[model samples]
Target: MRARPDSLFNLKKVLMNQPVSRSVSSQQQAAAPQSPQSPHAAGASGSPPRTFGSGHPPRIAIVSASWHADLVGQCRDAAVKGLEAAGPCHITHIHVPGAFETPLHALKLARSGQFDAVLACALVVDGGIYRHDFVAQAVIDGLMRAQMDTGVPVFSAVLTPLAFHEHAVHHQFFHEHLVHKGTELAAACVATLTSLRQIEALSS
Candidate 1:
């Protein structure tokens, strides 16, 4: 099924455009970056990335919130599909109470010593409460901090819109966006993992 136009996210548009990573040449591959860590160090703690020596498929956890069960479910499905299309990924799904709890779930799962990466999904829309912004910001910040603190790669599928009323029209829009977000996140996760592995190979 196709994602709704309102819901579909255009990753090419969403991501900051940059030059693609060039293939490793023997001479350049031999000349690795002087630093052991990349600028986008895995998580919030800033621990050096764990080098697995280039074998094994990375295990990634997809953490989602229960508040927007249906939409998030669709988003999760899209993510799973996207990840599968990319390659074999050990995807473990987890659920939090709401968007506010996504960061903790991501951190906890990342620190579990099982997952290589963490992907979080949530629809943090403004309810009647005046706290959606705070919750959304906190969730994003916490996820970043947690990853740096724990040294695991984390990707967010959580979005906080200025207005997200639960209506047929809004639902249609976000659903499509979720699919795009899923595809985008999947690509990022794979690229990030590959980059990390290349770095490790050079280090050794």
Candidate 2:
């Protein structure tokens, strides 16, 4: 795979900062604004307990759901951006017809022993049916199963919007959020992977 020149240096920087959960906790602490009622209160913070990012750059597969191609594409981009932020990763993309199908495709890739991480991105929206919920659950469950059964790390940014309407505000808001999610999730993935490798080394 060709190394993306612009992203390599920065990604290495992120990898060097491999979290002890300290930076993430600190970030959370800073994010909490002082309550008007109480100027200073003891604050609490945490990140996803899972450390997905870390170690050498990873070879990853990003799967996007096609039901909303435009929206899901943002996820794909965000993921790539995230991976770049973490380090120079080798990335490949797979487009599935909808969120429900992403897990299967990801499963195939994960089981192939070709990629270190698999990321599935999608937007499951309610269209006056129970289908979105069903698909969301199934896909998530399947991804988990694949990882557990294969020891392959699977990361998801597939979200079910609470109140997504065919309106401009919702679209714009979610799009912006998706970009952030992609970057953040990518960071999380790297952090988790690094931490896991760290523990594995310690145990050995």
Candidate 3:
């Protein structure tokens, strides 16, 4: 089936622009500038990237919130598309009750040592009276902590829009936006794992 117009537009944009790789490289460059001796560390061009380095296909876990499964599924599909574009990968799809639970689930996956990376996608919008701000922060923080503790890369596409109403127009817009975010997350996952391997090779 053909993707919706918004999803198509987002997929095209991600394919053309590759926001994830650029964002990662930018961060590296910023660090390079700080380390006087490695002024060109980030600028130096390297050989063409391999799809993936591990002899076996990489394993990825996708933890999604079920609260908005329909919309979240778009992100998951787009992410799978991006990952396949890079090369073959094994995916473990999962669903949790809500955005608040994504982190613990992600942590479990990361610690299992069964996945090369874990990606969490959720829509944490203001629910009339609840504090989405705190929930969003806590989930993000927990994801980061999980990665640091496990040495496995973790990425999040969890979005907390300041103003989100339960309407068709808003829903459609966010669904399409999620498609792009998914692609970005996939790109980041691949790039990060590759970079880590490169560093390991260098260190050894």
For this target, which candidate reaches the highest TM-score against the unseen true structure?
3
User: Candidate 2 has what TM-score?
Assistant: 0.71
Better structure of 1 and 2 per TM-score = 1
Which regions of candidate 3 deviate over 4 angstroms? 1-50
Ordered by TM-score, highest first, the candidates read: 3, 1, 2
Global CA lDDT computed for model 1:
0.77
Say which candidate scores most in lDDT. Answer: 3
Which digits, one per residue and each the tens of the lDDT, describe model 3 over residues 1-204?
886656755543453333322235776777765545453245556533437766678899999999888888898889888888888899999999988999999999999989989999888877878898999999999999999999999999887775676678677777888898899888788788788888888999
- TM-score of each prediction: 0.72, 0.71, 0.75
Writing each residue's lDDT as its tens digit, candidate 2 over 26-88 gives: 778899885664322235233333334445667888888888787778877977876776657
lDDT for model 3 comes to: 0.82
Give the Å error, residue 30, model 2.
17
Q: lDDT of each structure?
A: 0.77, 0.75, 0.82
Regions of model 2 farther than 4 Å from truth: 1-56
- The weakest ten consecutive residues by lDDT in model 3 span 14-23
- Candidates ranked by lDDT, best first? 3, 1, 2
